[model samples]
Target: MLFGPRPSCIKRLLVIEDDPLTAFDNEHTLKHAGYDVVATVDSGEAAVRFIAAEQIDALVLDLGLAGDMTGRDVARLARDRGIAVLLVTGRCPEDASDIAMACLDKPHSPSALVAALKALETMICKNRAPRKVAGLTTWWRPAAA
Candidate 1:
């Protein structure tokens, strides 16, 4: 297996953020946290193509991408392909729970990001809902799924 059954299934991540600084920071942080960041792209189009070509375990998606395709577009494709999505939204990002695992609002700490991902990993692996996280609102409907 590419990844083992434990520690963990959420190890491979694809970061899709338009802001170069944010992308770099996220990549650095996730790497420091021991995740194998597959790639960091700044456009939805690129994200889509990359997802089609790679075996990513999850995504850190920014809704306000600078490309022909929107982040929602990428999320839909990723979800349909059974890849987990972690949304990164601004102050008023559209609620896209239908296509995402959870939403993490902007101006959040790196620890919060890591917490959210761990929560997501638990939810996916255990098939249970996650508890509340700071600056995060989960829309995962595990039972319904």
Candidate 2:
């Protein structure tokens, strides 16, 4: 009997956007792209809490949040935990380049967002890291050590 290869693991994603409509769009885009959006929050504080409690594969964050903590702060925390991060913002910050894997401009098309996420996913996979930003039939496997 022949059997197919093992299935790839699903990646869990967290989205943080202050605007309800924008947050909804992000969630929809991620889900439509085959990512499992574990949770969507509007404030940095909530994002931090969610990160602490969940095994997040990646984060899709907005720079300006509803709480005292900024998206940069959350990104910093996530990076420290080895979680991949992508910043989606209207105005990209000079410092964002240091914390996130990539920064995406606002008003982006869903396809653009999916592409960005796929790029991030590729980066993470290259490092033997891992997200569900897009459905990729071909994935990069890390070379043998």
Q: What are the per-model C-alpha RMSD values against the true structure?
A: 3.9, 6.6
- How high a TM-score does candidate 2 get? 0.80
What value does the lDDT take at residue 82 in candidate 1? 93
Q: Which candidate has the top score in lDDT?
A: 1
TM-score of each: 0.89, 0.80
Clash numbers, per candidate: 0, 0
* Model 2 misplaced stretches (Cα beyond 4 Å): 1-10, 127-145
* Candidate 1 C-alpha lDDT tens digits along 29-119: 7888888899999999899888988889999998889889998899999999999999988853566778798899897888788878887
lDDT of 1: 0.84
Q: Residue 22, candidate 1: how far off, in angstroms? A: 0.6
Clash pairs, model 1 backbone: none
| Per-residue lDDT of 69 in model 1 | 94
- Sliding window of 10 residues with minimal summed lDDT for model 1: 1-10
Per-residue lDDT, model 1, residue 130, is: 83
Candidate 1, position 77, lDDT: 94
